[model samples]
Target chain A: MRQEHKETMKRRRRNIKLTVAYDGTAYHGFQRQNKCVAVQNVLEEILPAVFGDSIEIAAAGRTDAGVHARGQVVNFFSDGMIPIENIPKAANRLLPKDIVVTEAQEADRDFSALHSAKSKIYVYQLYHSKVPDPLLHRYSWQYEYKLCLADMRKALTLVTGEHDFSAFRAAGGALGMNPVRTIYEAECKQEGAMLTFRFWGNGFLYHMVRNIVGTVVKVGNGRLSPDNFAEIMQAKDRNKAGKTAPARGLTLWHVNY
Target chain B: MRQEHKETMKRRRRNIKLTVAYDGTAYHGFQRQNKCVAVQNVLEEILPAVFGDSIEIAAAGRTDAGVHARGQVVNFFSDGMIPIENIPKAANRLLPKDIVVTEAQEADRDFSALHSAKSKIYVYQLYHSKVPDPLLHRYSWQYEYKLCLADMRKALTLVTGEHDFSAFRAAGGALGMNPVRTIYEAECKQEGAMLTFRFWGNGFLYHMVRNIVGTVVKVGNGRLSPDNFAEIMQAKDRNKAGKTAPARGLTLWHVNY
Candidate 1:
């Protein structure tokens, strides 16, 4: 009877999971770095106190510096001793104000944060105001251009399909990684003075969404034509793309698994 | 005839008016002080260089330390011959990047920015997020309150008409200033995670809008009821009002004459 109880206890202790959101401006990225602010570093430091053990977590994606996340998923193995309902409150108290564990749940032992993702949505915000509002200075990129919404929409239509987006990938990006990806949707809209570019894809290449946004902005500003965007894509040369937009405006909107 | 021509030229040169916008994070306020960064000091230094004569600008309203402005109006008398069209560009070239002159126009000889008869509008922005977005760290106040819209709306109704707002005025405010003012409109709206408070009035006493916003927020958070707000206003004592909200979120939206 004692041996049977030990087996049941082991099975219940390994199914905990956590999902988090963070403003990445203060961290180097999602991964831990020596003497650097990182999402993982903050999580690791607090998880030990909550679970009473050194816990290892796996993130859905590794984000770059200054890249914010709204629904970034993370999973970890933890014992069932602590109630799952109290996980969010317990973690939040130990974490910095810039990061929060919005939700937590119990997951199967075989679940992995990386392999569970099916699609992701990203948004890039741009401000075409003559003078930047101090309130929105950090959340958006201020560009003094008369953006044409029709032109941006026309250019976006060219990117919504399976394509080897070599033209949009960052130069010297991850080696041995395929540049091809399937984009489900892409569009741009302007509300008053704020312009937003939203994209959904099965996966994104390095700097892919930002590069696409930059080229679309060029089309909006009359610097490039929509038809020319098609040509640049066909060229499959990274240099043929327009300049990359700044990182401040990019946000990981959601991750669908 | 030559003397008359010279007098006419001098009269034309003496009328100067400018429209300025500034990020108030780095300044002590709009007024000049002995040892502080003030918007007025920055303008005073640049105007003389542009006009080739000493000029004193009369502002529509004076903002406190850390308060921002977008449509601030100022008129000055200068005995110089700079073209009105070139004034905006010249002032922008000399001023810091945080300040900009969007428009400059010649004003009538009798025009005074302060004495103009019209309404003024102010907006206060609040970010109601569980975790602070790093990008918005300096721009908004991070408050984790489930604000009640209905209660806040009802509380605003009491202050719509002309009334002596002595209860909402700040201590050590300007002397002999009548607290009676007409509030033309007050609105509260929420977009995504942001809450904005807009007020249009014939005039505002020192810290009037901020104190009102604080009280309404208390009502929204269930700390003070809508009916209690009426009681506070009727008491006509500053001690009865809620605490002053931070200055960074307050903006002088516009001044009309």
Candidate 2:
């Protein structure tokens, strides 16, 4: 009877992973908050009703306020027997129109959506235009000035591979945290008025992508040269970087397990 | 003195044209409403403040609620002398984030934005997926079933050329309105999960694009045949067609001079 009860407990506690996508325009952020609504709070509040289980979710990244995610991964142990295929549809029925659970899968009990991820890809979108575009405002930033794509490309090459990114960290980041991170790839692509910056890294420090974009925009606008960009990276001081770009322009694009 | 005053009045009544774009998710519709906020209400209220004159605007199309527009045209008479180049910038400063005046130009005094348009183009967007996509919910309709694009394309050809389209007109449209209209072009393009239908026409009947889209989607899903679509067009009966697709999927793409 003891062994049977233990097996039943093991069967009940299944680790389920969900791939979430959100507009992020309405939520304060992906993390839970006290007074303000966040993506995390919505998920936790709504998921229990769908799965009939008390739940806690661990997300791959805690995106800041106004930040969006297309392939955000989260894992939680479920005490209910809802079929894996039905999870997305069930959760989506209860979630708001801005948030969606795109996919769900059962994983090994030890799988961690945060720690077990190998890398993540983030994309920052901006459009060069004299006037704002309403359709693109929720997903992209608008810059009135023209950007030199060649200069931005040259500066992007400096961000590849492992390097100390302390200069790119925001002011309120944890003290004594490791500032070195491996950026497998960094690229800039332009199509007409739109510019996209893609970054693939093992892990990113707080506000790292926005800082890099800000400093890179400076280079694109001829305020800083590629050499100056290199110097800022080597300085390892937050004050050496340019202003942080707005959160709405960045999206957590994908995560690799 | 009387002659001079007449000349001054003529000069002050210069006609101006604006190319407008908006994300219509929050608006009631393009036309002004008694109590509900609308795109027209926002524009009429703000443009007058920018131009320093009481303004009246005539738009190229009156889009329904939740329908977006990328190149809606509007013509208005301005008594003030603001530089044409600065009009977009000045108006955008006071306009809400969801609406923008993209361009401004002086037009002929007799030019009418609604009556002088040669043709207009509208696009309907939809995506086939098992689960809803949060990023696209505002701009596209999500269909859970697979669509046969080839069949949809075949049916779209029937929509081209001059036709009496009373069957596609929505209820409450002007009674005894002429149903004969020229469809300059009708085409469908599919990429991945997205399907876009483009209609270029001299003029579309009320809910014509939406009603056609509803019928075409039914054809794509195998509920109706291309022959059935042709018969519906010939029937000139609203009851013969499928349901009107949601307004969110339709966009006023452009207007030709």
Candidate 3:
């Protein structure tokens, strides 16, 4: 009877998941690295303290340096018994103010954060003003140009369908990886002097969204024609893409399951 | 004729005005202090470099420490002969990224940045969430409470007319001064998980808006009835008000002349 109780206890303690949000400006990335600040490092340090045991965390996506996340999903396994209601407050006390665990829930043992994500959304902000506003300097990229809104919208429409986005991938992207991705939606809108570009996709190639934004900005500024955007995608040449937009302007808005 | 020309040049140089914006998170306030970083010190250092003369700048309002500004107007007198067109770029190059001179124009000789303003608008942001997002830490105050939107709106309306808001003024404020001020409008709105409080008035006393927000928050949380807010105003006692909200959440949104 005692042996049976031990086995049941072990089975019940094996599942836990947490949804986190972080201002990634201060970390190297989402993955852990030696002698570098990463989101995983922060979680590793705080989760162990909260759970009273060393915990391994798995995330939905590994964001790059200076990329912020609003809804980053993470999962972990734990054996110690603690009320789930205390997880957010307990973890927050040990973690820095820039990393917050918004939700914690028990998951099935087979659940994997990375594999379970159905889609992701990213937002890139650009401020089209003659002069940069000091308040928005950290949150947006300043583009001092008169943008043609119609041309930008036209270019954005072409990016919505599934396509070989090799033209938008970075030159240093991984080898033997498929660059075909289905973009559910791509939209550009201007609110006052701020231009926001929101993209939803099944998955993205390395630097795909940033490069696409850079190309669309060129179209908005009349430097590149919107009609040529489709041709550029068909060519599948990385050199045909515009420059990568700065990472500071990019935000991981949400991850959908 | 040379003496008359010198007088005319001096007169023309004395009429200089600049519209400025600053991210006040890093500064003590708009005014200068001995051991603190202030917006005035930044402007003081850059003004002489841009105009090549000692200039005294008077602002439309004195924002406290950690308070941000978007359209804080200033006027300065300089005998230097630099073109008005060159002032914006030249000063911006010398100033830090947090401070910007958005518009520079010649003004009437008697114009004062503070006295010439007709009205000022201030915005205070409150994040009404169970947990604060890391990205909004510097820009908003996090409060965990279910706010009654109707009660907040009702309390906002009570403070919209001309009155002596001594109850809203900070304790130990200037003595023997009339706290009477005309509030053009006071509004509260909730967007998503954030609540915004905006006040437009001819002038504000020390910590007045923040004090008022604190009182309104009490009404919002049902700690104080909305009808009681008028009684608090009539009492004209600082002790009758709620706690003072932090300065970081307040912004000098704009100045209307």
Q: Number of the top candidate by lDDT?
A: 2
Alpha-carbon TM-score of each model against the true structure: 0.82, 0.95, 0.91
iRMS of every model, one decimal? 4.0, 0.8, 1.4
Model 3 residue B22 lDDT score: 92
For candidate 2, write residues A73-101 as lDDT tens digits: 99987787889998888899899999999
Better of 1 and 2 by TM-score: 2
lDDT of each: 0.83, 0.90, 0.87
The top-ranked prediction according to TM-score is 2
Tell me the lDDT of model 2 at B49: 77
For model 1, residues A149-172, the per-residue Cα lDDT tens digits are 898999999999999899998896
Superposed model 3: Cα runs more than 4 Å off: A1-12, B1-12
Could you give the fnat of all candidates in order? 0.14, 0.97, 0.94
Q: Please state the error at residue A30 of candidate 3 in Å.
A: 2.4
- lDDT tens readout by residue for model 1, B147-251: 888899999888898999998998989758988999999998889988888899999999998899888989989999988899999888888778898887888
Model 1 CAPRI quality = incorrect
